[model samples]
Target: MIPVADAFRSGGAQPGQDALALTGFAAEGARAVFTVAGAEEGASGLTVHYRTQGEETATVTLLANGTEVERLALPGTAGAWDTLETGVPLRAGLNTVTLRTASGDNGAFELSGITVADAAPAPTRGAALPYTAYEAEAGTTDGTVIGPDRTYLTVPSEASGRQAVVLEETGSHVEFELTEPANALTLRHSIPDSADGTGIDATLSLYVNGEHHRDLELTSRHAWVYGEYPYTNNPAEGSPHRFFDESRVLLDEELPAGTVLRLQKDAEDTADSYTVDLLEAETAPGPGTMPDGFVDATERGVTPDDGSDDTAALNEALAQTSSEGLGLWLPPGDYHISDHVNLTGATLRGAGEWHTVLRGSDGLGGFFGRGGTSVVQDLTLDGGATVRDDAGDHAAFEGDFGSGSTLQNIWIEHSKVGLWIQSPTDGLLATGLRIRDTYADGVNLHRGTANTEVTHSSIRNTGDDGLAMWSESEAVSDSAFRFNTVQVPLLANAVGIYGGHANGVEDNVLADTVTSSAGIAISTRFSPVPFSGTTSVRRNTLLRTGGYEPNWDSAFGALWIYADTSDITAPVVVNDLEIVDSTYSGILVSWQRTVTELSVSDVEITGTGRFGIEINAAGSGTFSGVRVSGAAEGGLDLTGGFTVERGEGNSGW
Candidate 1:
C-alpha cells in the first residue's frame, strides 16, 4: 500500500493531516509525488482514493517520471474517501509517480493516498489474509539461541526451533522480512518483571527497513512479575507469579511488504537479556474493535462510590485489562482512589472529564499511570480536600509511557504534578488538557522522550514551570509544546526547554509568572546530550514574567537562554532557532557557557527590565526587526559580538 505519510517527502502533501490519513493538495498546477515500488514490471494503473470538502468534479493528471500517463476524474464530494481509477504505463523497480491537479472546478481537493498496483481487479473488501511465523519457517539468527519448553534465552537453551531468538548483548539484533504489509503485529517475549523490583531490565528498538520507528521495553510490568502487591488489581490474589508465561506486545500500524522487522537490544546498563518465543501478524481489526479486547472493571466486582474506598475496585478493573489491549470505560461517578494505578495497552476512559471525577484519598501517593497504548481520557483528577504528598513527591499521572499512547481531555488539580512523563517514551500525544494548581511542573517531558507533543491545553497556577521539556538521563528530542496557555507560575519559567534536540515551544500565551524566571526559557541546565538541533520559539505572548520577585535580582525577562554549571565543559551549540514576536525583554541569551546560533526577528519589548535583546553569552547569532520602547537598559546589549541588521525602530545597541 502507498503510505500517505511518505507522500510528504515528495512535497505537496500534508503530513499527519489526520491520525489515519494524509491530505494531498489538489489545486490547479499543484503536484504531489510518491515513490511507488513495484515487484514486477507490468502495465500499471493509478487509483486515487480521496476525500473532498466540496462537490465539484476534479481532474488529476497522473505522470510517471514527469511524463503524463493518465487523467483521472474524481466525483469530488464524498463524506468518506472515494476512489477514482485510471490505467497507466509502467516499467519496473521504483517509479517516480506524480499526481498533478490539472483541473479542479472546486480549486483544491484532499487525498488520503494513491495506489499504483496492477490493473487486475481489486480484491473483494474485508478479505481474510493471515500471515504467521511458525517454527518451521526458515529463520535467521543474530546471536545464540536456546529454546525448548517455551523460550529462547541468549545465554543457553536445551530446546531450539524457529519460535525463539535471544539477545545476550545490548547491540545484538534479529531481522525478519515479510512479503506483504502487516496491519498488526503480536510478539511474545520473556524479560524480567519490574514489579518484581529486579533491577534487571531490557529494551528493544525496532528498525523497519533499516529506519528506526519506535522503542519497545522488553521488560515485564511489576504487577505481572509479582503476585498482587496492593496494586495488581488482579482478583486471583494467592496465585504465585510465574515467569514461564511470555509477555505479549501488540502493535497497530501499517507495514509495507519487504519490511525488515529488527529487534535490537539498546539499553546498555541493564544487564538482563531478552527472550522471544512467538511472533505473528494479521489483518488489523477495524475501528471500535479495539474495545472488544477489554474486560470491564464493574464486571469484575468493582463498585463506584464517593465515600467508600474504590481503590481496590479500580485496581481490579485495571488488572483485567493489563497487557490484554482492552478498553475500560468508567461510568460517571465520584470514585475515590487510595493509591497509584498502572496501566498497559488499556484505555481507561470516563463519561466526561467533568462528569466523572477520581478524588484522591488522604496520603494517596498518585492517581493514575500508563506505559503503553493505554489511554486516559475524559477524566478529572481532584487532589481531594487535603494533599499529604509533598512537592516532587507524587504526580497525578506518571509513567514511562511508550509510543501509540495518548492522554486527552483530562482535568488535573492540586497535585504534585499534573502529568510527569518519564524518558524513553516516543510518539506520546497529550492534548485538550486543563491542569492547574500543581505542586510542580504541570507537564514534564523528561529525558529520552522523542516525538512527543503536548498541545491545545491550559496550564495555570503551577508551582513551577507550567510546561517543560527537560532531559536528564538519556536524551529528549523532536518534541513540541504548542497552542497552550500558561499563567501564574509561582516558581520557575512558564514554559521552558532545558535540553533536547529539535524541541519547540511556540504559539503559547504566558502571563503572570511570579518568580524571577522568564516566561520562556531555553537552557542547557541538565541536558542528557549537547543541546543540538533546531528549536523554534515563535509567536508567543508573555505578559509579566521577570520582575515578580522583589528580592531576587534576575526576576523578569520575557525569554531567557543560557547554560548553567551542570552543563559541564560542552557549550551548547544550538544548530538553529527563531525567536519572534515575544514581549518584555524580547529575548535574553545570557550566561557564560551558553553559545548559540540564533535568529531574533519581529520582536517588540514594551517594559524596561532588561534590553530588548541581550547576548551576554559566548556565542554568535543575528538580530533583525527588534524594537525597544521603554527599556531601562538598551535595545541591544551585545557583550559578545553579534550581527544586527534591519533595525526597524530606534533602539540602544
Candidate 2:
C-alpha cells in the first residue's frame, strides 16, 4: 500500500501524512502524481480509498507513464470514505501513476491512500449449454489424419483439440458414437474454394447405424478470407485462409446415447477434399407458431414458391396490416423479392425459417421498419449477395423499431449484415434467431439503441463481429446481449461493445474467432461517444477464441479491454467468465489513451497459447478470484512499466 502523503500534489492538491485533499478540481487538469519505488514487474491490483460529498458520481482520469489509460467514476460517498479497485500493470523499480479530474465539473474528493496487491483468484464457471464435443481426429476414420499445426497463414486453424481428419477421396468416412441423446448436430468442416475465390458448395452424406440418413449442404462462400486484417475475399489480394465454416441440421428423430453416426464423402460429394474438424450435438427446441387473427399474404395477391418478384405484394400486405391493425402471415414457400418491403407497426409472421423463405437477388431484398411496435417472426431472409458492400444497407433486416419491437424465430443469411438496427430505437426483444454466413455483423444496435435485448440466438460464420453495439453518433445505453451462442466468426470479435453506457454481455457462448480480434471486446475505439455508467460482462464462456492480429503482427486475448479513441472512465465489471483454448492470451488489458475503474472477478482461463493474463497498457483495475492454468508463456505477462503484487490461490503459471 502506498500512502497519499507519498504522492506529489499539484494544482491545489494538499498532501497530508496519510491523505491528500484535492480541491478546485473544477479547474481543468488538476492532478496528483504518485511515484512508487521498488515495485515488482507484472499485473497487479490498484485500490483507491477516498471520500466525496458530491451528490453525483465524481470522475477522475488515470494516467500511467504520462499516457492516459482510464477514466474512473467515483460514486458519491456522502462524506464517508470508500474504496474502489482496478487492475494495473507496473514495471520493476520506480513507476509513475497519476490521477486527475476528468473535466471541469468533476467533483472534489479526498484520497486516503492506494494499495497495490497481487492478482486475485476466481472460481471456475462451466460452459453455458450441456453438450458433448467430438473431435474428428479422435473418431474412427478411414480418412487420413491432418494437423495440429498452425504455421501457415494461408490455412485455417483446426477447430478444436488442434487436429482434424481429411477425406481426400470418395467413400472416405469418419464415424463417432453419440455420448448423449441429441436431435441437432453441428459440423465444423472445410472444403476446396472456387478458382474465382467466390467459394464452392458441396454436400456431406450422413449415416446413422450404417443406414443413409441425409445429406448436409456445406458452403465456403462466407469463409476463406484473404489479404491483411479486416480481410477481403478477392483472392488476388493475398493468400486465402480462414478455411472453415459450420453446417447445422435438426434430425427428424432424437438418437439415443451410443448410436453410431458417420459423415462420408460420397460419390455425389464433388469437393476435392473434405476436412472435418469437430462436431457438436445437442437437443434443440421445438418450432414456433403464428398467432391468431393474422391475415394470409396470399389473400392479398402474394404468390409463393414463384421465381417472380413479390416485393410489391409484400409491401401491400404489410401496409394493410398497419392500417387495419391486422397481422400478416406468409405460408411455407419460397418468395423472391427484388426490392425492400417497408414495414410500419405491423406484425409479420411465417410458417418457419425452413419453410417460409424470402430470397433477395444481388443484395436487393430486405424488410425496413420505420416506427411503432413491429413484430417479425418465424421467417428466413436470404439475401443473395455474393460480396461485401459496407456502404450499402444490404442487411436482411434493417432500420429502426420506433419505441418497441419483437423479432423471434427468424433466420437470416447471405447478406452484408443480418440485423442492423439503427439509432433512436428502443425496447427491442430479439430471440431465437439463427444468423449465419453474413458479410458483416450478425446483429448491431447502432447509435442510441437503448433498452434492447438480443438473447437466445445463434450466430455463426460471420465476416465481422457476430454481435455488436456501436455508439457512433449517439450513446447506445441500457442494452444487452445475453444467452446467445456465436461461433466461427471469420474476423473481429464475436461480441463487441464500442462506447456504450450501462450495456452488458452476459451468459453468452463465443468461440473460434479467426483473426484480427478476440471472443469478446470492450473498447473506446472508432471514435464513439465517451462511455458513462457501468458496463457488465458476466457469466460468458469463450472457447477456441483469440488469434493472430495481422496488422499488429501480434495476438489478441479471448477477452480484451482496449481503451483506445477516448478515455474510458466508466466502471466495468467482468465476472464469472470461463475462457478455454485461447489461441493467444486468455485475458488482455491494453490502453492507447486512457481506461480506468475496471473490476474482474471469478474468471478461469485455461490453455492459452501465450499468457493467461497480459497487461500491455497503463490503467488501474482490480482483478480477484481469477484462476489460470496451462499458459504457454506463463501467467500474468505484464509489460509497459507495469508491476504485480503476488496473492494467494492462483495456480499453474
Candidate 3:
C-alpha cells in the first residue's frame, strides 16, 4: 500500500520509485506527465489519488510511448482529494502517463499520487451486500463505504441527506473506489431538474478501470434536490424524501480490486442533471426469511379450521406482543374471521402463502384492516363471502395508515377489491403478491398516499385497474410500481395514476387489457390538489391494449395522459413528467388539453391502433429520442397548441 505521507513528496522522483508524483492543477492544454517502470508486463493497473478544486470535470489521457491508451473521467471533488484506478497496458521497461483537462474550461485538480500494481484476482462473491446511505453531511451517517470499510472522499456541498451525488453536465462523472470488486451495482437516483423544463432523458455510460463498459439511459420523474421545486403548499415544507429510480447495471466482466466506477453522461448538448441517494452492490443473492420478534397465533387459541371465530384470538395475540415492536405469527391454518379485524402498529406473518389462509364471512365483508407501522406477509386472505348486490364496497385487506406499512408474499383471490388502501399512509411497500379475479381494482391507493411501492407482484383479471394511485382530495406523492406483471384487466387501465406528484411506474409488463382506456394511464382532471409534480413512466411493455372501450371515445392509448375539460383555475402543471423506453400498441400519449409540461423519450411503438402520440395540451411539451414503426395511424397526431422538440428516429408511422 502506498502511504499518504509518501505521495505528497514531489519533484524529480526516480523512475523505479514505488509511487509516481505528478501535479494535478494545470491550465487547459498543458500536459502533466509522469513515468513508471514495470517489473513484468502482461497487464497492470494504475491506482490514482487525485481530486478537483471546483465543479468542473477533469479528464486525463494516458499515453504509453506517445500512444494514447484511454481517457479517464475524473470527478470534481469541490476541494478534497479522491481515489480512482485504471487498467493500462505497460511495456516491460518504462511507460509514460499524461493528464489534461477534458474541456477548455477553467478546471483544476490536485493529484495526490499514482502507483502501478498487479491486476487483482477474480472475485468470489457470497452474500448479497447492503450499502447504507452515505449522507453528504460531514458528521452524520457518512462513515463507511458499502462493501469494505473505507471512508468517503470529500463530497460536494450541494449534496445532503437526500442526494449523495449531484451531477451537472454531460460527460461529468462521479467515481467510486470499491474496497472489493463488485459484480453488479444497484443504485437509486433521480433527476433534479431539466434546462427546458422537461423531465430527465439521458444515457449514463459506465467506465470500469478507465475503460468504457456499458451504458443505460435513465429517466426521472421527480427532483431529488430539496427546494428545487415548490412541492407542497408551504414552500418551506420541501420534500426531504428521495424517490430513486432503482437501477441495476450488469458488469458482465469481472471488476477487479482497485476498480473505479465512473458514471458519465453520454449526451453532448442537453443540460440536465441527476442525483444519487442509495447504492448497493450485490455479491450474492438477496436474503429471504421472515423477520424476527413475533408472538404465535396458535399459542393464543387461534386454531385452524375449527369452525370457530379466531379473529379475536389473533387480535389478542397481536395485543400481547412486546410494546417495542408488535408482531404475531399465524402458522399454517385456516382462521375464520366473521367480523371486521382491525390492526394497528403490528406485524402478522404466516408459514407460507397458501399454508395459512384467513377466511372471511358474509357478516365481515372487509377482512383485515390495518393502520400505522404494520406488516402483513406470507399468507392468503380468502373472501369466502360474495358481495351483496346492494353492498357499497368490500376488500380482502384494507389499510388506512400513516407510514411504514408493508404487505408482502400474500395471495388474495375472489374479492370485490383485493386491497383497498386510503392514505394518510406513506412509505407502504407491497411486494411478492398474487392477487387475481377482483371485481374492482386489485389494489388502490387513493387520497394522500405518499412514497409507496408495489413491486415484484402479479395481478390479473381485475374489473378495474390492476393497480391505481389517485389523488382525490390530497397529493399522492413519490410512489412507485416496479417489476409487476398485470394481465387481463377487464374494465379500466392495467395500471394508472389518476393524479399524483412525483410518482413512477417502471419495468412492468401489462398484457391483454381489454379496455378502450390506456393500459397505463395518467390524468389530472379528477385531482382536488393542484397537479404539477414529476411523474415518470418508463421501461414498461404493453401487449395488446386499447381494442375495446366501455363507451365510444373512451379507450384511447396504451400509455395515456389526459387533462380533459376540467375548468380548474390552477393549471395542471406536470413539471418534468417523462415517459421513456416503453413499447406500446395503442395510442401513446392521449393528451386532452390538460398536461402542462411533459417529455417523451426513447419510446418504441411497435403497433398502435390509433395514433402514436396524440397531443392537445395547452402548453409546450417535447417528444425526443423516439422511434415509431408499425403504427396504423400517424406517429404524432397534434391537435394544435403544443410545441414538440422533435428529436430523432421518428419515422414509418
Candidate 4:
C-alpha cells in the first residue's frame, strides 16, 4: 500500500523515532552520506517521520500536507528532520496520506496528531479510517536494457510481461518496442554493484513507442558481480544498493494512449532470460510532477541529442551531470553535435553504456568538461570523421575538471580518446569508466593531477593506448590503474597507463598483441620523469604484446618503468603477476638512472617466443620469486641488475 521511499518517519515530533524507511545523501567532495529513515502517521492530517545523521544539511517537505499548515521546522536540529502537516484535506475518522522529496534529501518527516472532527471524538468512542488508494504495479516489465539513448527500445520480446525483469547488464544490451502508447509509467530494476567494486558492467533500458526511455548502468560492483571482476575487489562491506532517478525515455511523455512496454537484450549480446513483472502505469498527476522513474546512478538513457546521436548525448550528459541520486539518461538516436559540449552538475539519465549513439559533427570533441561534477554513461561518443585526419582532441569526452569534482560510472567509447582528464584534485573517482572501439587512447590521463584512481574496467580496440594515467607532478599518488582490457586492433601502440607517476597498476588484463608502444609502457621519451610511490604492479593477466603493426617497435608487459634522471625511488613491487600467451618478448626494463626497489615475485611468463625477463636495468635492483618458460633465448637478459639472489629461469638468468 505504501511506497517504498515513503517508509521514513511518520509519527509526531520525536528524537530518534522515525516513520518511513529512507536513504541516500549528497556529499561535497566527501564520501556519500547515507542514513536510516522511518515514518508514522495518525488519523488527522498531521504526520511525522524520523531522519538520520548525515554529512550535510537536508530539507524535507510535506507531500500530503502543506497549505493550511506551513512547514514546521522542528524546535532544534536532531538526528532527524521532521515533516509537519499543512494544506491537508483531513476528513473524519482515520486517514492516510503520502509525502515526497524527489532528490538527494532525507525521506524522514514529522507527523502531527489528527483533529478530523471540529470536536474531538468522545473519550470512549473510536473513529474509523478514510479511503486511501495504495500504489500499484500495472504496465511495466523488468530486465536490463542497452542501446542508443534516444531509441532504447523497439517492440515487445517473445518473452515480454511474464515474471519480474531485473538487472539490465551493461556489456549485455537489449531492445524493446511498444505497440501503442500509454500514460505515466514506472519500471523497477536492480543495479548490482555500487562503489568499491568494478561497477556493475550491466544495464537496464526502456523503449517506449519506438523511442528510448532510459539507459541505466551499474555504478558500483558491490551487489551484482561481487568478486566477479578483479580490479573491483572493493569488498561488499557495509554498502547498500542505490536506486537512482533517471530521465524517462519520454519526459512527461504522453504516449499514444495505450503504450505497449517491452524489454529485451541490447546490442552485441544475447537476451538474458529474466523475470518481468508489471509494476504500474498511470496519467500525469500534475504539473512539475515526475512520472514513474528508475535508473542506475551510473547512467540514464533520457538525454538531449541536439545533433549528436543518442550515445553522444548520453556521453555528454554523463560528463556534465552528477545525477542527484539519479543516473545519466540518454535516449537512442545518432546525436550530431556541432560545437563543443561542456559538462556541469547535471544528471543525464539514459540507456545502457556503449549503446547510446553519439556522433560529433565538427572537428571538436563530442563532450568536454572544463570543470564541475560530470558523468557520462551507456552511450557511444564517436570522434566524428576518421583517424589521423580529424585529430584535434581524440577524446570524445575531454574533461579538465581541474580541481573540480568528477565521480564514477562515466563509460565512454567510439572516439579517438574515449576519455581524457586533467583534473586539479583527486575528486575524479573515475571508476568503471571504460573505452571501446576507437583508433586512439581509450582513456588518457594527461596534464597532471593527483589522487586519481582508475579501477575495475576495460579498454579495447584502438589505434593507440588502451588506458593511460600519466601526470608529471607529485599529485598522482594514492592513484591506481587496475583491471583493464587493453587490445589494439590496428597495431597502434596500445598501452595501459603510460608515463608519468608510477601509479598502482594491478589486477589488469592488458593484451597488446599489436605492435603498440609496449603493452603497458613507462616508455623511452616520458615527460615529468617518474613518480615516487609503491608501483604495486600485482595480480595482472597480460596476453600478447607488440606485433599487430609492422611499423611498431618494442612491447612490454605488466610495466615498463622507463624514465632517465628522474627521481623515481619508489619500488616496482610486481607480485602475483602472470604474463602468459604473448606475441613478442616478455618484458623489457630499460634506461633508469635512479636506483629503487624492483622486486619481481610470483612472476610467471609462459609461451613467450623471445627472452622472458629482458632486464636492461642499469640501476640496482633484485629479481626474486620470478618464473619464466618457453623462451628461445635466455630468460633473464640481466644487463645491470643489483642482485639475482633468488629466481627460477627455464633456460638462464
Candidate 5:
C-alpha cells in the first residue's frame, strides 16, 4: 500500500530535508505521520468509516493495489471517524486502500468499518424525451412550438397541449417556473461558490410538491460547478417546482430535529474563510418582468381609465417619468382611448410578467405613434381584436420617439401589425427594442428609421414577415427567427431581416421553417436611394428550410436578400462580408439583378439540394471560402450568379 504517512516521513513529500533529518519527505518540524487502509474489491463499490484522532490538517487517499485511486481532502479534528462511501472499481483480489497524513500536523488513523459490493446497473433512458417551447415577450401569442426536454414553449395555450417557460434568478440563486406548471419543466443553472473558509457539505435536492425525489451531494472543494434538475410529467397532472424551503430535507441527520436540511462541515482552521456568490437560473419564462426591474402602469393610476380626457394623462406622465419608469399597464380587461397613446420618458409596464394583458376596443383601434422614450416589458397586448383584417398594418405600439424608447419582454399578437416605427428623435439610441409575435411583421421598420438592434427575442406565428423593414440608413444585427406559425392563407416570411442599406445579419439560426418565406429576407430599394451602403450578411445558420409543411413555403432561405428593382437584380454591389455554415447554403447569394462588387467566403451549406454556394451574380460579385458537402445536388453552381474572384478558403463543397 502507498501509505501517505510513510511518504511524508521519508522526506519524499519535499525536495529537500533538514540537516538533522532525512531529505525530501519531512517538513522540518511537522508533528507526526500515520497510515490508514481498507479492503479492496473488483467492479462494484466500497464504503469505509476511517477513524481519525486528534486535530490536524492531513491528506487522505484511497488506494487500489499500490496505485492511487481517489484523492481526498480531510479535516483535522478530535472526533469519531465519519463514514465515507467511494464509488470506484478495483482489481479483483485484495486492493490496497491507503490513507496518510500527507502533511506533518499528524494524528492517528484507523478503519472503523469497510464494506465492498458489486456495482448496480445504470438507469435506463426513457423512450422519448419531453418537448419544450417559448413565447415571445414582445409580440402576441400566435402559435406555440414545443422543443426537446420541453425546454422551449412556443405559444402557451389557454387550453392545453403546450406550456410556458420562465427564467428566474437572484445573485446566487435561480429558479425556473412555467406558466402551465403541470407540463414538464426544467431548472438548469450555474453556481459559482467562492467561499472556502468554513467546512461545507451541501446537499442538492429536487422536490415534487412537498416530497423529495432526488438528492445530490456537493463538496466545497468543487467551488465552480454546473448542475441541472429536470422535472418531467404531463403539465395536466402537475408542474415541477424547485423547492428552497427552509423546512425541506433530503438525507436524514441523526439529530434532535430529525429531518433537517442544512450545511454540515468539519473544519480545523478559520482564516480568511468566506464565500459569497449567486446561483443563476436560466430556464425559459421565469417569474419576473422583462429585463429584470419593471413597475406596473395601471397600479399607478396610469391605466386607460385613469380619469384623463384621452390618453393625454398617461402620455403626460410618461414625459415626466424616469427612463426606468413604471410600465403602461392595460390590465386583463378592455381599455379605450379617444386619441393616440404617446409614451415618453417613462415605461409601459405590465402585470405578472405574462399574465396581465391590455386589449383595445371601440373607435380606439389599438395604439398609435406612441411611447416615444420608454422601456416596455412583460405585458401582453391584444389590440382591437374587433378591428378588420386589412387596417393598413396599424400597430399596437409604434416607436416614433426616435432614441429614448426601449421595448423588451412584450407579447403583442392578434393585431394588424405589432409595431410600425417611423423613426424617433435619437438615431443610434432609438433601440433596445424587441418585436415578437405580431399579426404582421412583428415590427416593420417601415422605410424611415436608423440604428436599431434586436436580440434574444422570438418572432413567430405572424401574418407576414416575423420582422421586416427598410431604410437607406438602417441596419439589423443579432436577431433570431425559428418557429412562427400561420393558419389559413399563409404566414409569409417568418423573418425578413432586410433593409435597403447595410443590414448586418449575424449569429441567427432558424429551424423547421414550413413556408416559401425566407427566415431572413432582405431587398435593396432603388426608388429613393441613400448616400452610401451595401448589405453585409454574415454568421447565420438555417435548419429545416422550405415551408412545404403547414407553416410556410419550403423555398425559404435561412438568410436571403434581393434588390427591389429588376434593373439592379444581379449580385454585384454587395461588399466586404463573410457568410458561413448556413443551413441549406452556408451563404445563399440570391440576387435578380447585377452588382458592382461582392465577396463570399467560408460558407458551409447544410441540406439536400443544389450547390453549397450559389452566386446569382446577374450583376457581378465575388464568392470564396464556400463549403458545401452535407447536401447540395451539385456543389457550386452559377446561374445568373458569377464571381470575378471565387474559390476556397474553407470550402468543402
Candidate 6:
C-alpha cells in the first residue's frame, strides 16, 4: 500500500500527509502518477481508497506504463472513504500507474491510498470466503420493524442498515434468498434477558426452503451489561444495555444460490422475543492439519475428548517441546485444563479453531507466554467462567511475546480478558483473533509496548474497551491497530488510547458503544508519562457510538479527545473519519488542563444527537473538509478557550 501523498502529481493536485486533494480539474492533463515496484508481477489486483461527496460520480482513467488500461467510475461516498478494486497488468520491476480525469465534470475527490497485490487478499482464518451480509430489515419478514433509532440505550442501535426485525410472536420469521453458495451462516441477534440479569438460553429454528433444517442455541449470557465503567452483569445497579450476540454454525451440506434461508421463532423456541439484526453467509474452508516435525501432545499422555484433566500432560508436552526446540501440536479434540500452562520459548499449534478446543471450568486458567519467542495459533480457548472475576488472573492468554512472535487465528471466549500483553515487548503481531464475551478489554497493550500491531481481528461483547493501549508505567509508542472490526463493547470505548505516542488507529470499524465513553478515545486519563510525538487516528468508521456517562451526568462524543489526568501537549491528527448515527456529539474535544495542536480533516458526521463538533478545551487546532448533517443541536458548538483556524470546505455549522 502506498499513501497518495508519496506519489508524484501534476495539474493542481494538492498533496498532504493524509491524502491528495484533487482540484482545478478543468486544467489540461491533470493527473497523479504512482511508481510501484512489483515482484514477479503478471496479473495483479489494485485497490484505491478515496473519499468524495455530492450526487455526481467521478471518473478516473487508469494508465499503466503510459498505456490506457481502463476507465474507472469512482462513486461518491457521501464524504466517507471507500475502496474500489480492479485488476491491473504489471511488469516485474518498476511500473508507472497514473490516474487522470476521464470526464468534463470534475466532481472532486481525495485519494487516500492504493494497494497492489498479486490477488485479492486472502481471508483470515475462520472468516467466510465470499462473505455476503443480508440485513434483517431488507429481508421478507412477518415480524415488527423496530427502529432506525439510536436514543434508547437498552435497544441495539448499531445494526446494519440502522434497522432490524423483531419477532414477537411464535411463527414470526424473516426469510432471505442466498445470492451465492454457502456452507456456513452467522446470525446476529438479541433476545430478552432473564429477570435476574444472569442471562438466559433460548433456541431459534432454521428452515431451508419449507423444511426444517436445524435448531440454533442462542444465549444472552455473553451480552447485556449495567452500572459504571468496567461494568457488571447485574441489572439492579443500572439500566441494561448492549443487547446483541452472535452465533455461527456450519451446515452439513453446501447450499446453492437462490436457496431460501429462514429464521423463525417457533412454538418450541424458549425466548419471548427475538430481535434479528443481520445474517452473514459464506463458504468456509476445511479444517487445518498439523505440520510435519511437530511433537503431538497425545504422545505425552495427553488424552483429548475423554472429559479428563489434561493440564499436567499439556505442561509436560510444553516442557518437552521447549527442550527439543520443536513445536507442540494438539489434534482435533477437546482438551480440559484446570490450571494455567506456562510457555517459555514454545510454539503451540492446533488443528484449527473449529476442531481443537481447550475447555476449562471455574478454576479456568490461561496460557502465559514468557522468555523467548512464543507462538500460539489456530485454537479455541473456552474459559467456562460464568461471571466476571476481577481478582482472578483469568485472561485467555497473558504476558508479552518476544520479538518476531505472534498470536494468530485464535478464538477466545468467556474469559476475564483476552490477550493482555505487558510492557517492553516489540514486534508482536496479533492477527486473525476472534475474542468475545470477555469480562474486560479484549486486547490491551499495557505500557511500553512498541512496534506491535493488531490487525484483521474481530472483538465484541467486551466489558471494557475492545482494543486499548494504556500507557501507565511507560509510554506505549509506535504501535498500530488497523483493519479490525470491534462491535458492541458493553462498557467504555471500542478503542482507547491512554497517553500513547506515535500510535495509530486506522481503517477500523467500531460500533455500538454502550456507555461511559466514545467509540474511539484519545485521552490522558491513566498514563503518568507526558505525551510526545504525533497521535494518528485515520480512516476509521464509527457507527452508533457515544452514550451517557453516569459519573459525569453527561454524554460523550463518538470520537472523543479528552485530557483528564494530564495536559496533552503533542500533535494529534484525526483524518478521514466517518461517524454515523452518533448517540450524542459526533466529535468532542475537552480538557481539564491544557491541550495543544489538534488537526482534524476530511471527516463526515451524520445523524448526531448533539452538536457535530463540540470543543471545550484550551487548545488551538486546524479543521478542514468537515461536513455534518442531521445534527439536532446544530454543529460546531465551540466554548471555553478552544480556538480554531478553520480550513477550507467546512459546512453545516
Candidate 5 worst ten-residue window by lDDT: 122-131
Q: Model 5 Cα displacement at 134 (Å)? A: 9.0
lDDT tens digits, residues 1-653, model 5?
A: 12231221211222222222222212322211211122222454666544445565444555432233655544544555565566555432212233423334232344333455542221121001111222222212222222212111222211011222222211111122322222122221112222332224444443333344454343332112121111221223332111110111112211121221211111311212212111111112223333233334454455553434435555555554454433444444334444456655455554422345555542244445443444455555555332224444347766564442445445554465676666542321211122333444565665556544443344444445555655534433212221122111124444454444554444444433333444455555434342135455445555443233223222434445455443333232322222232324434455556555555655555554444555464655555655556655566656774544655565555
Candidate 3 backbone collisions, by pair: 516-548, 516-555, 517-555, 532-573
**Reference-based lDDT, residue 310, model 6:** 91
Better model by lDDT: candidate 2 vs candidate 4: 2
Worst 10 residues of 4 by lDDT: 150-159
Error of 2 at 576 (Å): 1.5
- In model 3, the worst 10-residue window by lDDT is 121-130
Candidate 4: stretches off by over 4 Å: 1-27, 32-329, 389-394, 402-413, 431-434, 473-475, 489-502, 546-559, 565-567, 592-595, 647-653
Reference-based TM-score of each model: 0.55, 0.74, 0.53, 0.52, 0.48, 0.79
lDDT of 2: 0.77
Tens-digit lDDT track for model 4 on 1-653? 12232121211211222424333212222221111111222233333433435434344433221111223343333654444334444322222223334234343332222222222232111111111111112333343332211110111111112122343453332232333233444333333333444444454455655565655342222112222211123446432211111112223555564454444446632224332323234332222111123243224443354442444444444544444433344454455554566666543433433235555653345666666544443344555433333335446766665432433334454455676677554445454454544545666677565555554454554545666666644335445664454543333344544445557666666653443346556542445546555667777776655342223344443346564546445666777767775555667666655445767677777866567776665665666667677766767667665345565542344
Model 3 lDDT per residue over 1-653, tens place: 34332221111111222233344335443344444444445577777777676767777665442335667777788867787778776543333444444344332555656666852321121101122222322212222222210111112211222125555656666666666556667554555334332346556676777888887556543222233221211224443222234344545655665676666655752436555544545332122233355666777667887878887876677767735464777777678876566667677777765367787664254445456566677777766433222154458777685454667667776566777777777666676677755656888878888777776677865657888887788878777776677765655688877776777777677765554446687765554455546677766777665434434544457777666534122322222122222223344444445455566666666666556676655656656556666666667777657666665655553
Q: What's the CA RMSD for each of the models?
A: 25.0, 15.7, 24.1, 18.5, 24.4, 12.2
* Top of the candidates by TM-score: 6
lDDT per model vs. reference: 0.58, 0.77, 0.56, 0.44, 0.38, 0.78
- Evaluation by lDDT, superior candidate among 1 and 4: 1
**Predicted candidate 2 versus true structure: per-residue lDDT over 179-285, tens digit per residue:** 98888897888898787888999999999999999999998875676776546778888767667776778789999999999999999998999999888886544
Error of 5 at 498 (Å): 4.6
lDDT of 6 by residue, 267-373 (tens): 99989999999898876545655665588888878899999989888988999988997889999899998888888878898887667889877627788767566
Off by over 4 Å in 2: 1-135, 149-163, 177-188, 201-203, 213-225, 228-233, 245-259, 278-290, 641-653
**Which residue pairs collide in model 6, if any?**
none
